[model samples]
Target: MKLSKRLQQVAELVPEGAVLADIGSDHAYLPVYLVEQGRIRQAVAGELNQGPYESAQRTVREAGLSHLIEVRKGDGLAVLGAGEASAVAICGMGGGTIVDILSAGRDKLAGVQCLILQPMTDSDRLRKWLHDNGWRIAAEELVVDEGILYEIVQAEPGDERYKDSLWYEIGSVDLLKHHPLFPQKVSAAIKKIGRVLQNLRKSQGGLAAQKREALLQKKKRLEEVLKSCKQR
Candidate 1:
């Protein structure tokens, strides 16, 4: 099975020989690919909707991996048992939704060693959530697939000891700045966040003012990153 570039990057971040639980496993592609590649022995492909759940089952069966890959129909981490999976992958969702799933399924993460998250939006919020809730981002990468720039974060259970002020603002800039697509991705994010700041500047209220201030700070950080990228 061929995984998208984004999903491929996510799979690579999974620890070798891990029992993976892929939440929101649309077609169970990642798990199947990993199993076929001998990267993982067992996997749980969790899907919330009936259509995708059936699709995942079919994918596993067609790959003759039904014995190794279990297609479970449930929401978020509810389909997982404590200590059942060493790594959990949640992808193609908003950062807010991912955070909600992790928050709601806190107990299910007891034995999980890593979280590979690909947030479709609100990534900054997700980063903050992870940091505030005692998860540390061990590695982060950006991949451009089908003309879309995706950010994948690999997090591990840890205390709030690591601090990076630019994490949410520019994302692992120091690590990813040399990537071929880094400049384009950073430029796009800066423009999007700039628009957000513009809208916040137009609104009138204490909340709007507070948001504007926060966004301004982020914009400044992004600008610095962009400048550094240019100089490189």
Candidate 2:
């Protein structure tokens, strides 16, 4: 039932007493840990690829929680039925892929109460998608695990208007500012975007300048936030 720091963060956001769906559930570790802790009574682990899918099945079987957790092999939300689970957790995937899965399975999400997601990259795109598609950020956390930093987001059905555009880039400062790794997280973001700017400097092609300018602005904002976090 032991989980990595990143998965542990995602597990913290899962609501208790609800059926959870773990999408792209590698080895189905999160669900197994949740069930073992009595945080949830049931879960459906969905894996897209065959190898991971079988691995999930074996994990569930070996844990002797087969009755409590169902390991399903299917792509995205295809293995999930409409309103079958209240909490849907999609982790260990790219933001765009998560968006595409959620978009394609809108009907299956009819009765979903909340969504817990951990995107490997392009979290800004995922946050923007949540705002555009009638969901509000309930909670967010930045955790450094195994020398890598990860973001865990818990969203619910609602609406919101961000006070500043930076919210999309670094998640809501109000929620993430208190994290121990907040400054480090902002610094990491600045460094990542800075690398993109470095590559853009080599290409002056169509829109490259415009894109670089936008990234520079984002980097500036992030640097400002990082400075503030340090001051605090």
lDDT of each: 0.89, 0.91
**Stretches of candidate 2 above 4 Å error?**
196-213
Q: After superposition, how far is residue 178 of candidate 1 from its true place, in Å?
A: 3.0
Candidate that would win on lDDT? 2
- Compared with the true structure, what per-residue lDDT tens digits does model 1 show for residues 1-232? 9988999999999999999999999999999999999999899999999999999999999999999999999999999999999999999999999999999999999999999999999888888888888888788888889988898989998875336666675566656778777788778878988888877766999988888888788777778877888888
TM-score of every prediction relative to native: 0.89, 0.92
Which residue pairs overlap in candidate 1's backbone?
none
